[model samples]
Target: MIILQANQLSKAYGAETILSSIKMEIKHRDRVAVVGRNGAGKSTLLKMIAGELPHDGGELIIPNAVSVGYLPQQAVLSSDKSIWDEMLDEFSDLLAIEQRIRLLETKMGSEETLSNEASYNKIMKEYDTLRADFEARNGYQLEADIRGILSGLQFNGFDYYHTTVSSLSGGQKTRLALGKLLLTKPDLLILDEPTNHLDIDTLTWLEGYLQGYPGALLLVSHDRYFLDKIVNQVYEISRTHSQRFSGNYSYYQEQKALQYERDLKEFEKQQSEKHKLEDFVQRNIARASTTKRAQSRQKQLERRDWMDRPDGLEKSVAFTFPTDQVSGHDVLRVRDVTLQYDDQKEPLFPSSSFHIDRGERTALVGPNGVGKTTLLHMLRGQMPPSTGSFQLGSNITLGFYDQEQAQLRSTKTVLQELWDRYPSFDEKDIRTVLGNFLFSGDDCLKIVNTLSGGEKARLALAILMLKKANVLLLDEPTNHLDIDAKEVLEAALSHFSGTILFVSHDRYFMNQIATKVLELLPSGLTTYLGDYDYYLRKKEEEKERLALDALEQPKTDQEDGAQNESKESFEQQKDAKRKKRQQERRMAEIEELMQQTENEINALETALLQPETYEDHEKAHDVQLALQQANQTLEDLLVEWDECSTDNA
Candidate 1:
């Protein structure tokens, strides 16, 4: 059945129509991935479908009884509620039903012998029905299920009962909202950029959960791996239109290229035929012998229509940095670099020693708070190391892209920002450079605050590329870019002849760009001589080595420090084993529930299939309740299975 259908949907803001004549349909369990550049009206369309915003010139048809839950780009939670209370909202209706049944039972037991025979019979029947409904729903175990979801989403170690919603940060609030939405179990789930602030482990957990989701889902994200894992359908939203591709992300990319090639060939053929027909008509129009034939061909030519070309095609920018001078062989050197923040006892980077060579591209990787950004700051000479010496090669010019984009002035217009950065450039030169980065006529007039995150990042990058630097230091450069823009940057970096050091969590981006990898563990840096993929392989080998070492080595006084060093490794193994046992127990329970629920569902389906079952309304209602309970219970069980598997992995 169609869950949602929108026809000729259009949305306008002020005088501009952001989405015009849009149409799409979502089916019961279709996992649709939405892709588009920033400000292309993707979010506008999602908001319209979710009923959070209204459309100006269209209608959205949602089939009756179909439920939808939408998670916005930012989640808002009430300050007064605790995380536990907020999650409990998802099961409020079921809890209310159980409460009502409990109260009825108490009243029945307290005072009352029914005065009338019919009243007593009605009371007994109602009580029996409610008990069966409650049991079938598995209403008792809802709290346990919710707790598991919270833990999987990275809320572990926090007391859910005591943590109030107001105490959480933006990312934490968004994660909490996601957990609640998952527990709500709507027929359709809509998430926009859900992985924005998630850690790698949290993202992996979510991917597994979504891959096995039974309900329909639609999401907008630039994380390729996440989309490829969860979504089956890809919807490409261009500036003027949208098209559906019939597979995952990789498949869509290949199929889309083939489609464009085919269309280009067809277009060429039609143009050739139109030209030939025009020539024949012009040559023979005046001659009596061929006048009739020419007229017939003219009609055919008039009836011919050309296919419209696809929009949103950006011509590849063909330019590279002009290197006026080469850096020395030793691009950079850091010795005994111990760093610490004010009021923080732990040094972010302790006694780190490393060197960079000319034209080398290195990636700095660690968890969020593990000094990747701090290290970049130190390298750029922005911050002083606590105790150590650092040196730069002669004739080395540094170009930096920090998270703040410090070069941009917030109050300036887009054109003003570029003009101020390049004061020596002529008016024409500034425009030419800005045009390459998609800044045009009125767009350039917009203030910096008006631009989206991706646009701002692009503008910042465009300015950075103009600087002729031999050494580049970029921190989280690809944070807000779309897939297409990311590819553009990747291509540019591949051709760049400068020494590059950047921090990035995007595995694909790192693999394409980095020639070496630097892992910032608690113990300074462990260097690897290859890209991200190679680092992953080496990491697995290291883990195996540690597992073997655990079996071979024994404890000693001198080895106490070494044992302390291996604490992270030991903790991970312990967690892995604990998760494995938890998964086994949960999987067994879920399997039992799944079988029981399936049996109940089949029994009700059989009853519904029979003509006589509909005659008694009470029996029919009872069976319907049973079917609904079975479905909810099965959904809960499937979610549990996903969480267990994620924990184990």
Candidate 2:
């Protein structure tokens, strides 16, 4: 059922129209995403839909009984009650029903009620109905769900009953707010930038939970990976308008590029025809013989409806890393480096040892509070490690992008901010760099302290670009960047000849940027010599392997003669080589199947891009659905491959 719909919806701030003639709809189980560049009115639209803000025009329809839960970008909870009590408030109806069932049970056992046959039967019937309702609403699992959601949000060890929401940090409060919303299970779940503070593990869990969620989801996020996994439809708001696309983020990107090309070509076609008509009218209007024909052509031209030029990416940077002076083969080297505060009983994390070669992008990932940023600070000489040391290669200039935008809080004007960093750059050159980042004449005069997060991020990037560093250590570089900016940044980093070692929570960005992954555990660091997807497969395989080993407990030593019996049996199995041979054959089969599935997927994607396929909406959808199935097949094949590879190794 259609739970929400908007037609020509609009909003304005006095004379400035923030959104115009917007159209949107959400069905009962739709997984929809609203995306656009920063300040494109995405949040404004969400606010209107969530009923926090009223629209200036047009219709916003929501069914009377359909509940809507909105979690804005900066969601927070503040209450005097403990966190657990606040969460329990979400299930008060179920709790009430449970209480009624218990009261009925007590009444049925009393001697007075049982004495009247008809009343007793009525009481028993009521009890049965209430019990069914309680079970159907999952009254028994309410506490379990509260615990699970809180734990998933990283509040596992906290005293949920004693820790009041008023005592938590802003980020912690936001997490708790999300957990409470999950428990409520409203008909429509609207989340804006929900993945902002989630770690990799929590993100994975949320994705699984939402995939099976019974209610509809309306999300706005810059995390493309999260969008790709959760959203089935995309609505992009641009230039005070909205356009709907049918697919995940990746598919939307693919289709958007093709659409841009199609638009450009159509405009060029019209321009060519328009020029020919104008030329004929100008040259022949003076001659009586062809004057009538020319006049007719002019009328036709005047009557033609002109298509507006396709506007896209209004501000874009011409960005590249020019590696004039190359670094040594090894960009960085760390040995047994660890960090611990004086008051801590143990180290912040285990000793870490890793190396980055020139031109490699390494992703540093861990759970929240695992000290990923602290480690980067130590490597950059901003802090000292408690143990061991790290070194940067010769001739390397290190550039850092701090996620907090700490350097941008100064009162300096935008122009002065860049000028302060590169005093060598002439005024015109400084202005040019700032312009590329969308800081214009008056914009350049705006104080840095007043810039929005996106503006600050842009300024920070402009500084990074001009630094000319051969090695980059970025901490959450994409934090406040819009999707457009992140794409441009990804493209720049992907082609950089320099080396990169960065920490990020964006899975899509990690996959796009990292050639290797450094997993930082509390005890130690582990390295994966592949991309994020590869690392995930191996990680799962390691768990499976440990489980298998645990199930096979080694036989204890028996009498002296029989002590080595189990070892002798394993030796006999090795001599047979049957299991080893079977594993090898199975591994080969998995590899072959993987290749075949990938080929099928690629073929489907190619077909999706073909005019004969894409121009026909029905055909394109069929091919896209097939492509999704094929990709799922490939993932399954990878899991099997991991199982075989781990055992064989």
Candidate 3:
């Protein structure tokens, strides 16, 4: 069924057109992605479809019966209700139905109603209908559904029953909003920048969930990996026009390039023929013998329609990081480093050690609030580690790109921001650099504070390019960049001779530029000697190996017992065996407790590391104390397990 259709849908802000006669359609279960550079009106188009904004012209058709849900980039949930209650609100009608069914049951069981066969039957029928409706809606599994979605969106670690909606971080609120939207199960779901705040694990789970979603999905995102995984159809919105491609983002890229090439060739051929006809008419129109032929050619030219040349390639920021000198073989070495925020709660990672070699691009990946940014800060000496140290190799010069763009002077103009730093450079040279970054003419005169996020990112990269450092430390460098800018940065970094240690949630960017993957867990860091895809494959293989090991463990134990049965007398062996079994059970229980304690400590540590907690002295202190207690319990459990094993032996 066609859930939505927009024919020549046009939206404009006063005189400025945002969307120009755009056509799009969404059928049942269609997965469509809207992609373009920043300021290409992708979000505006979504808002128009969502009915949050009025279109200036054209028609948008959505079936009256078809339900639609829209999630914007920044969705604020202003409620005093707890997370679980807020989610339950999505099913208020079902809950009301359930209550009605209970009331009907009460009426049927009353002696007054039961005495009358007609009334009893009527009440029972109502109850049955309500029950059927509830079951059809899967009302009994409501809590399970909530839990599943919360877990998929990485909210399992949260205390849903106690945590109020107002207390959540912006990202957490966005996730909760998404969970609520998913539970509504509208016929058409539209999401804008849905992957903005999601970590890799959550992104992976969301991709799978959306892939199997029953409703049609219309998404606007800069995440290429996500688009490639979840979207089957891609709509490229450029210059206020929309072009549809019947495939994933990768397929769209390939097909778009091919289409452009074909159009360009065709356009050139038409231009060539037109030029030849015009030349012949000009040379022969004056001659009496060929005048008739010239007139015929002129008439043919008037009758012919010429093809307009295909649009020139869209303007994109050009990026390159060239170093005048190469770093030593060992670019960076981190030894037993532990990052801790003020008030000194739990460490980010427990005594993690890793190294980056010269010319190697290592991607630092982890869940949000896992201190990926802190680690970069420590590496660059912007922040000190609570424990241990890191060192740069000899002759290595470091360049840092802050995702926040905090290094840029807000008081200075865009041109001055670069020129002030490099005073020796001529005005033309500075303009040349700015032009390459897509800032030209009056654009360079804009103050740094007035620039958009994308512009700031470009300026930062332009500055980084001029630094010519041998070692680069980047914190979410692709955060504000559009798809084209990201691709440009990826290409530049791929060819960069310098070593790179960067943190990013963009899996596609990592796949393109990273030679190695560093996964930071609460336990420590694990290095995967390959790109994002390779790392994912290895992680799956590891899970399978562990599963198989677990399945064979009991059999291995039984075999060992069987082989030892004949080696001893019945009574003595039986006594020892019983003691051994008891010890083993105790050890297992202690080990489980130890693991739980460690997890609790890690969770507390993560909580303390959050900006809100660290900023509050009392909260940080309480969490720090809890973390210490958890650590003590874990230590005692380990000692008890060791003693038990010794006694059994």
Tens-digit lDDT track of model 3 for 1-649: 8899999988888788888979998889778999998999999999989999998889999999999999998887889999999999878899999889888878888899979999888888888888999999989888898999999998888899999999999889999999999998899999999998899999999987997688999999999999987776788899999998766799899989999899999999988888899999999999999999999999999999887878766999986899988778998888988988887678877998888898899999999888898888778888888999888898899999999888775788999999988999999999999999999999999999988888999999999999999899999999889999999998899889889988999999999988899999888899999998899999977975775454445446667675355333444655787888788667656754664686688789899979999999999999998988998898889889889978976
Give TM per candidate.
0.78, 0.83, 0.84
Q: Per-residue alpha-carbon lDDT of model 1 for 1-649, expressed as tens digits? A: 7898878888878887788777787887778888877777888888988889998887789977998999988776766688898899877778987898987776576545455566667777888888788778777778887887898888886888888999988778888889999887788899998887776667878887886677899899888877776776787777646777766787789888988888888888888888899999999999999999999999998787767654426453334555667889899998888889899998976688888999999998875567888888888878999889899988899988877666565878988888888899987888888888888788788889767777788788878877878788988888888888888888888888889999886777888899999888767788999998899889978987887677457778768677766776777877787777677666655654665676678778999777787888888888899889889989988998888777766
Q: State each candidate's clash count.
A: 0, 0, 0
Q: Estimate candidate 3's alpha-carbon lDDT, on a 0 to 1 scale.
A: 0.88
Which is superior by lDDT, 1 or 2?
2
Rank by TM-score (best first): 3, 2, 1
Q: Report how far off residue 641 is in candidate 1 (Å).
A: 19
Off by over 4 Å in 1: 97-141, 309-319, 349-351, 387-389, 521-524, 544-649
Q: Candidate 3, which segments miss by more than 4 Å at Cα?
A: 110-113, 554-649
What 10-residue stretch in candidate 3 is worst by lDDT? Answer: 562-571
Could you tell which candidate, 1 or 3, scores higher by TM-score?
3
Give candidate 3's total backbone clashes.
0
